[model samples]
Target: MPRTRPLPSNDYARRVAGQFISISETRLNTSPPRRLHLNVNILHSGFVPSAWRLPDADPRAFIDVAHYVRVAQIAEAAKFDAVFLADNASIADQIDFRPITALEPTVLLAAIAAATTHIGVIGTASTSYNEPYNIARRFATLDHVSGGRAGWNAVTTADLGSARNFGRDTVPVHAERYARAAEFTSLVKALWDSWEDDALVGDKAAGRFIDTSKVHPVAHRGEWFSVAGALNLPRSTQGHPVLIQAGGSADGRELAARHAEAVFSAAQSFDESAAYARDLKSRAAAYGRGPEAIRVLPGLTTIIGATEAEALRRRDELVDLIPWSYSLNRLAGTLGVAADTLKLDERLPDDLPLPGGGNGNHTFFHATLAQARTHGYTARQLIRALAGGGGHRVVVGTPEQIADDIEQWFKGGAADGFNLMPDALPDGLQDFVDGVVPILRQRGIFRSEYEGRTLRDHFGLQRPVSPHASADSGLTVNA
Candidate 1:
């Protein structure tokens, strides 16, 4: 029998292919063949702790729409691929050392859409704490409002405090949470597809607006949730806003392979990141998907300066600003080993037996240990190097040096792109956009002008349609 189904377009592959073409087609443009994918990881007003304390930093920028808008405008001016926001469901510990997350990402992104154009807005949302229908509608609205410059970063809650706040006695099992996340995503997409792309006719001449036949109810009855009928909103610009995943565990990788177009990830070294990227692509191939179907972007924290000495000074300044106790406890929580078991000058005891199963934070613990082993550093040295964040790669250098590292990694096949955590907020990003982006664009590694719209478009991905809906058919999905 002939095939009943046609092949689906690779949403992630298209973006990668576009970059390859941009690099190869020298005659089409004067730009170089260099391809750069940059995302500003807007973590608590950007990565630097003293960022809020900087003279240029607005104390209340965390909650102010204008601050985000101004930042988005700047990112757009630099022709960045996207701006990413990381969110947690619960406010776990407020140490007064680092800034805590305040404004919700979806709302913040919507406000940002009004202030800028072209740049992709990616937001983190948990499957554990939210209902599928609401999240589906929210992203759809954001996509429409932003003309399709929207993406959803699917996350499963990892904090115990979040479970308590949600009226649960305890956190769900890790594997169980992954199972629910997978299904939750499926439900959300179904809801987005509830209405076909052209469900709205607006035919006032005949007193008809919608074709009810084109609208369908998504009656989902699954182990974790059962959403009924169609969602209130229609499809957004990308069909389904670009699906991004950020879990590093084995289970996490499996989920990314099955669905994610791009993944936000971390590894301590180029070798580690290369292994991760290789594994994800290999898994994708096993699932009968192409290697370019999922883009791997490891998180990187950078302190950039005009010169090497200036950059080192900047790094030292951030290190000096970090409170010892805060770093101590954070590291302790990561290892699932005790704080008293550790001393500032001592080594991480190899004799401390590894957990039989769960540490609640395996990725960081392993990465930190790997960094220590790789660099032959002791506890104090490691803590100083890691600073506040556990194990993401940290680089302090001149703009040219930073670009060189990124280019080396990209060309070496260790990464498809980077999720940048600038040491400070407004200033940190400003220095990068003005100082670094131009060099990459001039080298033909990054785009000077946006070739397409939508988060998927930036990634060279095709818009995903509802599974049941044909290319000609609109979806009628009820959430």
Candidate 2:
């Protein structure tokens, strides 16, 4: 049995208890109310590279199971929809200065799921390097272990470091990666749907264990892979773990439109984000999915304080802690230029082209460029604005001010919700849960308590029925 951690202190519990409003009381409008979906991205110590240097931070939190459990507990207490984890198969970061994502996401998430209930656990798994059958089985197990609160953030790896680790001399071309991703995702879904919902029958009296007639083989053969399917497990509680995709290129958008239930977007401004949301939904509609088929959750970093000045001070302190050399190199990687190409006092190079000849991470490249070009920021200024990160929008202010910004983005159709990456972990997440959550609750846009158990329920998504659940499909489970 997984050991359970205690909830917040009694004082905090009472305070949150007082804020709870029943669903009946909040339903005033004739139209359906749009509640906010917030997921905390537990990025090691936190989003900032210097976060591990904080006095209260555990330098090894990136690999500490207890650290993630604590963060998930806080998010669940605050009624956040989920806790998200990003993964890398290689040493993708400046590891000398910060902790890299060292643990596999599903493994870490399983530990987190054991320690908490209610909060969804979403993890990234790259289609670039994984077999479809393995990816499907891994997340299915997570969903079952988490009681249907698992989400897979499907992505394609683009970094050369990841390629070399996979025994490849070069990164796959942009189109090929996305194409493989699309097929990879489809095959995974098919495997998940292999067993009909009622296929299992534990009737010892009748000496029957399963209805073999109901199990179907996917028998998928595509350009990138060939798979004989019918996963060994039954469909999970949510039918399939919530499918998520995070990419900004044209190919990425098409994949999301066809398959993704939620997107972790990296748009820097309201206009850009809203436009992206609109375009993505339009594409989804073209694929015969409804407007609500996908949720656009933009990445947001928050630095909170009692006052705006205090918040700015906090932001400055964290940003200043980052070594300029590290920041410059990281920025250069995103912009596809040499570190020396960027001058602290000068704007980005006027003739910047897409990274890796248009094959690098297009999401961050465009988002970071938009922020710099929009404000005409020098390299130094841009780093400060980004809170020493790459592309996500950072907001530094009091809880109210931060709430106001979130409100604008949520109500303006710029986002469905936010994938939060705080400046530091446990402490930073605690700050938001204690300070920002109450305000969001009072405003009637956020949940005071969870209404359902599954991740699909939290996102207000329907449990999907297996398309292969036919009485006489003339298919059998693969050996």
TM-score per candidate, in order?
A: 0.88, 0.92
> What digit string (tens of lDDT, one per residue) describes model 1 on residues 1-479?
01112112333323433343343343224633446688888765667555666666777777787877877788888888898888887776454766678789999988887777789999999998998988898887788788888899998887788999999977888888899999998888778778755555555556666667667899999998988969886666567688899988898899898878899887889898999998998888888886657888888888888799998887777776677777777777667677777788877877444332562655666788888777777777887676566778888888888888888888899988899888887778888888878777666778878877677767766555555554433222211
Runs off by more than 4 Å, candidate 2: 1-31, 471-479
TM-score between model 1 and native: 0.88
Model 2 whole-model lDDT (C-alpha atoms): 0.87
Regions of model 1 farther than 4 Å from truth: 1-34, 351-359, 471-479
- Minimal lDDT window, size 10, model 2: 16-25
lDDT of all predictions, in order shown?
0.76, 0.87
Q: How many clashes show up per model?
A: 23, 0
Worst 10 residues of 1 by lDDT: 1-10
